[model samples]
Target: MVNFSLEGKIALVTGASYGIGFALAKGFAEAGATIVFNDINQELVNKGLAAYEAEGIKAHGYICDVTDEDAVNALVAQIEKEVGVIDILVNNAGIIKRIPMIEMSAKDFRQVIDIDLNGPFIVSKAVIPSMIKKGHGKIINICSMMSELGRETVSAYAAAKGGLKMLTRNIASEYGEYNIQCNGLGPGYIETPQTAPIRTPGHPFNEFIISKTPAARWGTPEDLMGPAVFLASDASNFVNGHVLYVDGGILAYIGKQPK
Candidate 1:
């Protein structure tokens, strides 16, 4: 039987205080992996802890900004000492600036790139040595649809995600010899609390998305569970440098014809 279980493994998912990160970490827990996560601050970490506790999962939570290289390295060291050497690293922490390209400030652009692009590089770097020593690892970068397609008000987000896609492939190329599989999980427009307003009936953006997507709806956090687990487990042992887009068929379609 093909094994999909993550028994006896340690998974570290970044920015898992809420949203997609929290959901993916929860999935790892369900798959029998020891869950460890981090956030940029204590409050978010506390919230994440409570959320995981509510689900009856005993997750290890920490406060560390993925954008801070020193903090990420220290966080990895602490987790190795406190939990175990991370067997799976999920570079899920990210940010977006929805300003138009011409109107967006250089500072804003750099901030998004710093967290979304540089952050993954830092966290992944910190964990790879341990993975190398252990002789196996899985690194999942939370890429976005913007990695392939661009939008009007998401100049920086698109650029960062695009770079992340390449980074994902490069890591797999560099580390596959050590049994490390690096991949990207690109989530489509997900309906979270932050997007609740725009998802209301008759919202132009929501309608536009529904019309564009073949699945005709926003993706749920639950939709990412299986894909995340698969990539983190032995099920995908031979799969490396791939971007699995759990986008409800949006990327496969060109949208409906005009009315």
Candidate 2:
């Protein structure tokens, strides 16, 4: 049987205080993996801890900035010491700036790239050596739909995610021989609290999304859990350097013709 069990695994998900990252970590815990997560501050870490506890999951939470190379290295070392070698890593920490390209400042653009692209590079670097030694590993980069498509006011975000897509492929190329699989999990417009306002009935943006998607609905955090688990488990041992987009067929469909 193709094994999908994450038993005896240690999974580290970044920025898991809430939203998609939290959902992924919760799923991992349910699959028998020991959960380890990090946030940029103590408050978020504490929040994540409480959330995990409320879900009956004993998760290890830490405060670490993924964009800081030194901090990421140290965090990896600490996790290794405290929770066994990290068997799975989900680079889920990122930010997006939706300013138009001309209006967006270079500083703001760099910030997006720094976190979405470089942060993954830093954290993945910190964990790969141990994974190589251990003979197998999985690294899932939380890429976005912007990785492939572009929108009017999301230039920086699109650029960052595009770079991340390539980074995911490159990591797999460089480390596949070591039994390390690096892939991208690109989520479509998911229904998170942050997007709740825009999702109300009759909202133009909501209608736009619903019309564009072939599935005719927004995806939920739970929609991503199974795919995350599959990529993290032995079932996907041969699936390396591929991006599994959970975009509800948006990427595959063209919008409906005007009535």
Candidate 3:
């Protein structure tokens, strides 16, 4: 039998209070891995814990910022003490600013880069040591379609995600010998709370996304569950430094001809 089970694994997903991260963490729990998550503050952590509990999963939650190296280190230590050495890490914490490039301040750009790019770097560094000792590890960075394609008003996000793609590859290259696999999960046009407004019927962005996507609809958070599980499990042991784009085939298709 192909071994896809994570019966004795521990998974830590950053910013799993809701949305894609929550869905992925829940999937891990369903796969029999012990689930741990973190948020930036106590409030969000509490909320995430409650949400996980609501799903009948006793997820361990903590308050930590992935951008802070010391905090991330401490968080890993605490998880190791409380739950177990992390077997899987999902770098799902990120933020995006929608201001046009020209109008956007450098401070704002750096903030996005710090959170989206640097956060993963910090967290991954913290966990790799334990993983090295354990002889195997899986790190999944939640990259975006912006990692490959550019768009208007999201200069910083695109740049950070682009950097993250390279970071994912570099980690795999440097750590593959240690039996570690680093990969990226690229989500495209997901329908989340943040995107709910734009998805309203007849919205230009919605129409644009639909037309661009061969699937003809925005992807749901649930759509990523299987991919998340695969990347986290032994199933993808040989798959390293790859960015699996769950974009409903948008990247491959050009678009329908304008009527």
Candidate 4:
């Protein structure tokens, strides 16, 4: 028995195919929010839909690249007209490219920025009008540990996520009077498909990460579900413009060096 409930709210989650997005969507469903899942991969979307349906959750999947403005606008319009007003929006679609700063090309940088940063802007712009019309909403942006702590090969990703933190705050300040709450979740190296390859012993950054993370372990997608549920539900009605770190206390350390 949970204290939080989104009994009649509708949620729109981007990047719902796998990883944190999927977990957050399912969590919202369990809390009674009708889920509208979007991902670029149709097959994975179908898989998610099936998984949710098997659980008897009200979930639907749509194929849309969150970076495309027109497509995002159309998708949101369709949802508003055909589905229902989205009371919650989770901008979780993002991509990462690991390369030395010297070797990182403008194209590569833009590619990362497009998916991680621009996509959120596009999707949030499209959905917020509906939220504003309703005079209440919740927006959660999935940031990263890099949002605050900079890293070597992930400059673009870090910049984008850092920008998202401010964007969340800015939006929250702008709409707080209208009852719209905007917040960000900065996840550490979670043991999902996204971070699995990087979690191996031989991976150069693995030991360093473990040493830095006070918890001495990588986080999982499930670790984030509770936070997402709190932010999406009425439990966090007064919480806004905050970036909650779910990083195994990694950010608290001075560096990767263990004490």
Candidate 5:
């Protein structure tokens, strides 16, 4: 048996319709785990279920907004009662709004924080009790490069991700006695629909990112799968509260020219 295999785990991936969430869900299903996938888009949710069904994998989809506490709790309860015990929970739903700090309205800032930060809090609170009862579980929060570094025009996103990092640590510390592990995956500018607009031909920020990233290339969704698989499986049973950066060495440099 492979050391990192999740053969009998029932994995629940939020926002599994596309991007990193989709990749992680499919990967875990391929690794022999049953998947309970959720997304805000009904079309994507159905498509995800169909994809796994065609592959003869056990999977299902639920359309629920992660930010709604009652909805999240009900969904988790239904999954536990019907689908199976979710051995691993991947909090991969996130959004970014680009606006200058001074021009950003309070509504916009709060919106971002509600989805990126509070959404996870609500979902985790809903699912963690069952995990505690089970005495073993894994929680992988998808953070971002901005978690540690500061950037302009995305203050709310930065704050939410930064908060998520500490939340992961707190959860790990609080739950480690129950044999549960919590960790984070921070991706830097991965190639996905959310990033496409910014990297288009004439986008001013594209060149800046390329120059700043030591790899000189944007990361793809596949770039994140390995980290997710590791952190979600028994391979990382003892690894908790770690914010593993999947950036292409971009955070290492201070943008200084070589002398």
Candidate 6:
């Protein structure tokens, strides 16, 4: 029998106050995993707690910045003490800056890289040792479609996600022997509060995204639930060092020819 059950597992999803991260955590809870999440501040953590409670999931929420190495290390230790050794980790915390490459300041570029790329590195590093000792683990990096494709006005975001893709592969390479499977979960243009403005009907970007996607619509947070659970569950034990892109076939299809 293919085992997709996450029972007895503890999952730590970073930046799960809302958006995709929250959805993923909720899915894990549905699959029987104890959910633990973190946000950058107390307010966000509180919000996340409230949201989880509203959903009937008693998730443990914490305030920790994923970019701070020491803070992440401490957070991991605290989770180990409070919850249990995390069996699954989802590095879902990140930010993007859509400024054109030429106009984007170096400071802004570094900020994107630091949060999107380095943050995962730090958090993953903090958790791997315990995972190694425990004999098995799953690390899912929340990558992006930009990891492979680039476009105008998103230079920094593209660069960060590109680096993150390689980082996901490298972690899998370096830790596979320890029974740790590290992979990337690349989401396509998802329908979130952040994308609400652009998704209005007839909006140019909305039209562009719909035309580009073979599904002819933006993906919902629900679209990623099953895939994320598969990657986090034992069903993907043999799947490592690969990226599972949930991009509504956008990556696989070329846009329709002009009528």
- Candidates in order have lDDT scores of 0.94, 0.95, 0.96, 0.87, 0.88, 0.95
Candidate 1 lDDT score at position 6:
94
On residues 1-259, what C-alpha lDDT tens digit does candidate 4 reach at each position?
5458988899999988677888888888888888998888788789878877876776878989988899999999888887899999999998889899889999999999999988988988888888888988999999888889787899899989998998899989888888889999988888877567878996877887887788988888789989999988788989999999999998887765334
Question: Across residues 16-36, which tens digit of lDDT does each residue of candidate 6 receive?
Answer: 999999999999999999999
Give the per-residue lDDT digits (tens) of candidate 3, residues 176-242.
9999999999998998998999999999999999999999999998899999999999999999999
Against the true structure, candidate 5 reaches a TM-score of 0.92
Per residue, candidate 5 scores C-alpha lDDT tens digits across 1-259 of 5478889899999988767888888788777788898888788788888777776776889999999999999899899988888899999888889899999999999999998999888888888899989989999999998889888898999999999999999999998999999999998888888778889765778888887899988999788888888998988989998999999999897774855
Q: Can you tell me which runs of candidate 3 are displaced by over 4 Å?
A: none
Better of 2 and 5 by TM-score: 2
Task: State the lDDT at 56 in candidate 2.
Answer: 95
Q: Candidate 1: lDDT of 25? A: 92
RMSD of each: 0.7, 0.6, 0.7, 2.1, 2.1, 0.7
- Residue 89, model 6, lDDT: 95
Q: lDDT for model 6, please.
A: 0.95
Looking at model 2, report the run of 10 residues with the lowest lDDT sum.
95-104
For all predicted structures, in order, the TM-scores are 0.99, 0.99, 0.99, 0.92, 0.92, 0.98
